[model samples]
Target: MPFTFEPLPIAVAALTFLLAGFVKGVIGLGLPTVAMGLLGAVMEPAQAASLLIVPSLVTNVWQLATGPRFGVLARRLWLMMVGVVVGTLAGTGFMQGGHAEQAATALGVALVAYAVLGLTAIRFAVPPRAEWWLGPVIGVVTGLVTAATGVFVIPAVPYLGALGLTKDELIQALGLSFTVSTVALAAALAGGGTFEAGTAGASALALAPALIGMTMGGWVRGRVSEQMFRRCFFLGLLALGAHLASRTLI
Candidate 1:
């Protein structure tokens, strides 16, 4: 492992994943989003994304398996997952191939859009009749974005929410979708040659603090007012996104 960094950056990475995992433990999502946005400051988007794969994949798998309706949701969402794979592979190297600045700008834009949607709390519905077609479309778009920015919750999360699943089921469904996205992104990164042994080791080491944070967050979830927390979260994301966008565009 020849990667070099001062102790400050290492501390930042630890704190970033800890915080990111805590957020996920509380809200059931946002681990990759938080990690990517914060880590982007100290590393390339591709490298940041590489560091995210292990923690996100392991946590989401746990989320997916803990649910009661795995078979049903798996059957329902397989089409969308396939689309995700296709989109990710098709868009390989878009972010890693000398497009770092554009990728950062795009990452900032993603964070901004997601924050605005969260703050507004707008909701949409998808008729049962439309899921067959719409789901895959959303998955493809999500996968393309994941390929670029390492965030996959955009259209996919909203669409899953619209499916009218119970709370537990929705969380599990998200886990399923995100697991697919993580694996696809790994394949894409590997294909691009950015997912090397040292990078893989870095991602593996991040899992510990992430798990610790998730544990702490699970304890806090029962005590905290999630609404207030979410408001603050989105506001912070808005500011972070704006900072990234401004810093890059300036």
Candidate 2:
């Protein structure tokens, strides 16, 4: 199909990307998660996911490069990456099916769960010996979730947080994981026939606003109390999730 741009959705996509990017700049994550949440409210879940592909890939690549020990981290995470790819491919059928709304609802619930987790001060640790088994498991789960809803959080972020990585390493690891997931997701969407030139164009257009918002957010991060900002951010996510879930249910 040829690309057709609608003024309203384009505006929504631009604004949502900017907001999502701002959140990511301040917090170091939540670009896709926040974008999908807000976009799902207005667009088809698959379309929202499609819109996320370009910006997510580009920013995360930048993130991955700016971090420490890329090769070492990649080597350590190889199995997990493999699992993420395979699982995403396997799960793409859900997004292509008639149950796309269900996927959106699931995304809403996932967002709520993520927000709640963020609000809490819970800490989970993974032992060095356990990474071999846990890594692939978390990867597959994250990939499956991404395939369904275009948001990759849940077990993946938490599991990575459990590993005793330094702050920079954690950020880099997350970027690596998200980058791979974005690529896998784009492939899946293309194969499923849900992403085409039209959506790709919109996704590309959205990149400008997202990058601008990210730059602004980075600047704000230095001025504000991170802890306070995080609290407000999670609270907003909680509300957004509830709203999306309600729409799906009601």
Candidate 3:
């Protein structure tokens, strides 16, 4: 933590969080996704995840708390949240395993799937009646994926999109979900003995840059075309994902 890293890695983290935060600010998500994709390339998945916790948790909490419907959403989404926690706990040991290439490949596949979902702009409709069972199922799948790759946006994001929420509710729901996922991940990491104080410290310091980038991104959201921005962002993810996967396989 505390800038103890070599200048190169320190600078890399500062810039990476800054960029990742900006993307989240603009689009209302993607901080962890971007952070994991980029950082996982340079370090172990567990280490990258450790670096992700503070920044992602802080931002998502802010996102969750700022909403007016927090209590109502909590009541509604509790089942899904419970499932995420359970699934994450169930996946305790997979991420910290000794298989570097396997982890990298898993991360890559997650990225590609996420990128495709974003780029395709595919939308599914979930009737309000279905949330009780469907929500938990989706959460468990998302949690299992998160346990493997340290990314929680797969079926979760898609499932959320299908819920037919108003714009504000959707945003708040994302915050709550991501916040839960982050906490679950922290628990999983701790349980697996992969959590590190240094990584947490460095990730904490990353908060400043992430915040600054978010502010700037919020400002940009009004001026930039979000559709075009999303296309570009997902395209970048796709390329990065392919490289990570192919690099390991080859």
Backbone atom clashes (below 3 Å) for every candidate: 0, 0, 0
For residue 54, model 1's alpha carbon misses the true position, in angstroms, by: 0.8
Cα lDDT tens digits, model 1, 59-172, are: 899878888899999999899999999888888977766665676566567768877886885855799888889989988988887887787776787688678787568768
lDDT of candidate 2 over 138-209, digit per residue (tens) = 899888878877877656776776786765677688889999999999999999887898889888998999
Whole-model lDDT, model 3: 0.77
Error of 3 at 114 (Å): 6.4
TM-scores for all predictions: 0.85, 0.86, 0.83
Cα shift from native, residue 168, model 3 (Å): 2.3
Write down the worst ten-residue block by lDDT for model 3.
Answer: 224-233
Candidate that would win on TM-score: 2
lDDT of 3 by residue, 104-212 (tens): 5776787688778767757569898999998899889878878877877766766776777665676688889999999999989877767667667887988988888
- Cα-based lDDT for every prediction: 0.80, 0.79, 0.77
What TM-score quantifies how close candidate 3 is to the native fold? 0.83
After superposition, the stretches of candidate 2 with alpha carbons farther than 4 Å from their true spots are 1-3, 98-100, 103-121, 222-250
